[model samples]
Target: MKNMVKRYGFNVEASLPKVPNHPVESKEWLYGRTIINAVRVVMKAQDVQISIFGAENIPATGGALLAINHTGYYDFILGGIPAFVRGKRLVRFMAKKEIFDTPVVGSLMRAMKHVSVNRAAGASSMEDARKHIEAGELVGIFPEATVSRSFEIKELKTGAVRIAESANAPLIPLIIWGGQRIITKDIDRDLGRSHIPVFISVGEPVDTSGDPEVATQRLFEAMRTLLDETRHSYESQYGPFDGGEPWRPVSLGGGAPTLERAKLLEIAEKERRQAKRDAKKAAQAGGRRNPVTALIARLKKLIKK
Candidate 1:
C-alpha cells in the first residue's frame, strides 16, 4: 500500500468526486461543472429553495452508486447540483427514452452523456448500468423505480446495489425531503414554493463488493434511514403524517424483502460470491488478490477451527 489515507465527514453522504484513472478527467469536466453551477445560480436567482446535508463525505476519486429519493422530477436537478458544486463530477442517470425525445432538454441530456434505460426491457437496463459504472462515472438512480404519488414510498429497486457490487463502487443514499413529484412544475412556477417541500440529504457510503448480499441489505437499510431522517425532518416542522405508511415490494429494492426482483438479485449475489472466490483462488495461485477476496478469506479462516 502506498501509504493509504482515509478521511470522514458528516451532515452529508459520500457525494465526493471520484473520477478514476482515465483520460476523461481533462475533457469538458470543468466545463460541465460550470454548466451545473450556472443551473444552480439560475435556480437560486429565481428563489428556488434547496437544503443539502452530507456535503463532505464524498470521496476524492473513484466510482460511486447514488440512491436518491424520487420526489419531484426536479430532484434530479437538486441531486446533480451537489456533484456540480462540490464534487465537480457529472452524474449519469437512468433517464427514460421519452426524455430523450424532447427537443432542447433531450439534446442537453444526450450531450451531457446520460444513461437512458428502457425499464420495460428485462435485465437490459441492468447490463447498460454495469457498463457505465465500469467506465468510472457517477451514477444516480431513484430506486423506487418511479416517483410515488402520495407521501407513500414504494418498494425500492435494488439495481443500485447490484451495480455497486458489480462495479466495486460505494453506494451513497440520497433523500429529498419535499417536492412535487407529479406536479413538479407547480413548485417552479409558484415562486420557489410547492405543496411538497424540497430538502436534499446524503448518507454514508456502503461498499457493495464486500459481500454482495450483506452490502445490498446495508445499502437499502441506509436508504431507509435517510428517508426516515428526511421525512422526520418534514414532520418535525410540518407536523401530522398524511397517513402514508411505508409500502414494500419484494427483492426489488435493497430492503424491500420481496420476491419480484429476487431472481435478479440472487443472480447478482451469486456472481459476486463467485467472483470473490475466483479472486481468492487466483491469489492463492500466486496472482494479485483484490481486497474483497482477502477480506473474505480472512473471515472464512475466522469461522473455521
Candidate 2:
C-alpha cells in the first residue's frame, strides 16, 4: 500500500486509542467505520498523498462546528480526516437532501447519522445539526454550500455561524487543496492512480456568538486565509504554478474563471434548471388534460377488468 507512513505525510496509520466502555463507545458506528475503511482502501489504490496541518486545532472532545470551504466532491471526505486523526472523532456532515435520497448511499448516510438538508426547507436540517453539536458530537458544514468553479472560496451562508451560536459550539475553519484535481464540478473525472497530493489545513476556532453576518464574514476571511496559505504551500512543494492549471484559482494565474465570471455562470445554470423544471410540470399538466390520452387510459383499464 505504498507504505502508509512514507506515502502519507500524516500519521493516519497509528493505532487508535482505546475508548472506555460505555453505552456509546466513542459515538462511532460499525457501518461508518466500514465505509471509512473502504475509503482508505480506495485512497491507497489511488496513491493519494495526504498532508495535514494544524490537526490539533480540532477539539479532542465536545461539540464543535467545522466550517469548510467546498472546492470539490472529495472535500467532505478529506475534511474529516483531521478530526479522525486527532482522536478518531467522526463528523456528521450536513449534505444536500438529494444525496440522502439516493439508493444505497442514502441508507449509508442515515446509518452514519449525517444530516440531510433540503434547500427549500433548511430549518429542520439546521436544527438537526445544532442538536448533534449540542449533544457533544462534531458536525461539519460547507459554508460555501456548493463547489466553487473558480477554485476560490465563494460567498458563505450564515447558517454555520447561527448553528454554532445556537449550539454554543466551537466554530472551526478548514480548507482542502488539490482535491479538485481528483474530481470537481465541470471537470473531467480522474479516478485512476495519479498519486495526487491533497492538503488539509485546520484553523483555530472562530467566535460565532457575535452578529451572524459579521461572524460569517469573519469565518469567510479565516477560511480564505487558510486556503491561500495552503495553496502557496502546495505550489511550493509541487513546483511553481505555471499559469493555466485548471485546478488552480484565477487569482493564482490559473485557467479557472474569475470569481465574478463564476458567479455569472452559476446564475445561468440555476436559471436553466428552473426552466427545465417548469417545462416538466407544464408537460405533466398537459397530459392530464388531453382527452384522447385519457380515453386510451380508460379503455386500457376496462380491458384489464
Candidate 3:
C-alpha cells in the first residue's frame, strides 16, 4: 500500500479519494451520465427495476482491472451503481469509438476518458485499458467481446487478463444479469425503454500473487464464478439464462500466446504495407520518393491480387 502511494500518487496513508480529474466525471461526461440516470429514474417511475449486490468489495484506492460480462450497452447503467457506490466517483470505461463519436455523446465520452477501440485492428480494448491502469486509475472492461445474444453469457476475451497482467492492476470481475432489455438498435421500439429490472453483483478482487499467468487464470475463474452466481440468483426472478460456460481467458495479457501463423504473416504484411505507406507519405511530402523508399514499396506491395 505504501509503495502504491510513491509509485502511483495514491495516498495509502488514508482512504483513497475518488480520482479527481477522472475522465468519466469530466463536466461533459457527467452531464451525459446525469441524462442516463435521469432516463433511468423516469424508467423506474414506469417500473423499471435494478438490484445491485456486493457493493462493498470495490475499493476506493489503487488500480483495479474491472472485468465485466457484456450484455448490452445499457449494461453500463445496470452495473455502474456498484462502482459509483464504491468509487465515490465515476471510473473510465472503454467503449466503442463510434458511440462516443456521436455529436453529443461523443463529447461526453471524450470527457469521461472512455477508450475508443477500432476492432478491425484485431487488438482488444485492453491495450487502451492498460494505459489507464498504468496511471493508477480505475477502468471497467467487458470480458465478452460483444453483446450477449439472448442475455445468455458468452465466451470471455483475453483482453481483461491482458490489462491486469500488463499493467499489474488488481482485477475486479463484475456479474451482470437482466440488463439485456434496456435499449435497442431497432428504431420501431420506443426510445424510452423504462424500469427494466436488473440484478448486479460485484465479485471479489482477483488474487494476482505476483504471477501474471496465475493472476489472469484466477481472474478468468472469478468471472465465471460471478456469472454463475448471477444466473442462480436471478433465474427465479428473471428467468433462466440460456448461455453456456463462459469462454476461457485468452491470455494473461488477454490474447493467446500461440497466435496463428497466418495471423502473424498478416501482421508482417500489414507492417510492410504500413512501412510503404509511411515511406510514400514521406516521399510525397519530400517531393520525389527516395530510391530506398521506392524499392521498399515494390517489396511490400507484392501484387498477388
In order, candidate lDDTs are: 0.60, 0.83, 0.59
CA lDDT, candidate 1, residue 246: 29
Candidate 1, residue 161: lDDT? 77
Order of candidate numbers by lDDT, starting with the best: 2, 1, 3
Q: Estimated TM-score per prediction?
A: 0.61, 0.88, 0.60
Instruction: Identify the candidate with maximal lDDT.
Output: 2
**Positional deviation of residue 288's Cα in model 3 after best superposition, in angstroms:** 26
lDDT tens digits, residue span 185-247, model 1:
212234343333455667888666655567667766787778777666755755554442222
Total clashes in model 2, counting residue pairs 3 or more apart in sequence or in different chains: 0
Q: Which candidate number maximizes TM-score?
A: 2
Which digits, one per residue and each the tens of the lDDT, describe model 2 over residues 1-305? 11233212354333333333223424455534676677788888998888777776877778899999888899878988877766567889999998999998999899888999999998899999999999888899999888899988999999999999999889999889999999998888788999999988889999887789999999999999999998887888896767888888778888988999989989999899999999999998887767888899899999999
Q: Using TM-score as the measure, name the better of candidate 2 and candidate 3.
A: 2
Task: Tell me which of candidates 1 and 3 scores higher on TM-score.
Answer: 1
**What is the RMSD, in Å, between candidate 1 and the native fold over all Cα?**
19.7
Task: Tell me the spans in candidate 1 whose CA falls farther than 4 Å from its real position.
Answer: 1-34, 181-197, 207-217, 234-305
Report how far residue 50 has shifted in candidate 2, in Å: 0.7
Q: Cα lDDT for residue 176, model 1?
A: 70
Question: TM-score order of candidates, best first?
Answer: 2, 1, 3
